[model samples]
Target: MIDNRDPLSRLKAALQVIDSQRKILSDSKSDEMLVRDLSAIVRYLNSMSISQASHILEKAHRRGHDQKKNQAEDFTQAYNLNLDDIQSIIDSENVTRGELESIAVGRFQVPKGSLRSIGNMEQLKMKVSTLVQNERSHQTISKLAGDHKYK
Candidate 1:
């Protein structure tokens, strides 16, 4: 005899089985691991509901779109730069506005001059310092010699 029972009773029986499985898995796992896994499962189950899942996905998509828009907005534009602004920085600092403008405008190429004068300038500075020291030494020697001659 095929007897038709309540459909809700069948759902309840399935739920009980799932609950037992969840408890068994939780019991086997460490407390921390159990909490993490259970939390993930709960989140996934909640998302399975059509409205909740759509809402989460919609929020995520909106966030991603906004992030890309913000990134695009952050990009530097050539039109935003001013020649006076570059010149002001140069006047206030050791760097020149022309050099800054050249750097800013990729098309404006500057030739790298030879550093040959750098070594020469460094040698000249060292020579000047040495000459000054030598002059002082000579003065001291001359004074000592004069004092000995007088004694």
Candidate 2:
């Protein structure tokens, strides 16, 4: 039996109970038994306190952010691209033509008409940089606006 005094402990106990119940439900042969178990599990979760629900939501939010950060790091490593270079592109309002030429021809050595099977490297880089900047700006605005809860 779980001690109901401590909210966090109770939350953990509920999760463990749910996990065990799910395993049993998966192994059950009868459809009626499965339905009953599933309904019980849903009722248990629905009975959780607001504080417990918030804690669970915060944990999920942090996990999602960590996953996205890990994926971005992996992509940067796989492509042999510097994080600073990407950040610089995102921070800048507009990348000059000279900088684009330097990156495309001098740095990457991407041949003309090689990018997107038609466009030149400079054109592709410019488009990509602009898109990144716009995305960054949008994220900044959203963060400033903050999250809103509706009744």
Worst 10 residues of 1 by lDDT: 106-115
- Superpose all Cα atoms of candidate 1 onto the true structure and report the RMSD in Å to 1 decimal: 24.4
Taking the candidates one at a time, how many backbone clashes does each contain?
0, 0
lDDT of 1 by residue, 24-139 (tens): 77778757676567657654554355455455556766999997675334323322434445334334536533333333332122222322232443343343334345656787
Q: Candidate 2 on 4-67: residue-level lDDT in tens?
A: 5555566667677776776676677547677577768767776788697768767877899997
Span of ten consecutive residues with least summed lDDT in model 2: 98-107
Candidate models: Cα lDDT each: 0.47, 0.59
Per-model TM values vs. the true structure: 0.29, 0.34
Which residue pairs in candidate 2 have backbone atoms (N, alpha carbon, C) closer than 3 angstroms, thus clashing? none
Please state the error at residue 88 of candidate 2 in Å: 30
lDDT of the structure predicted as candidate 2:
0.59
Identify the runs in model 2 with alpha carbons over 4 angstroms from their true place: 1-30, 81-151
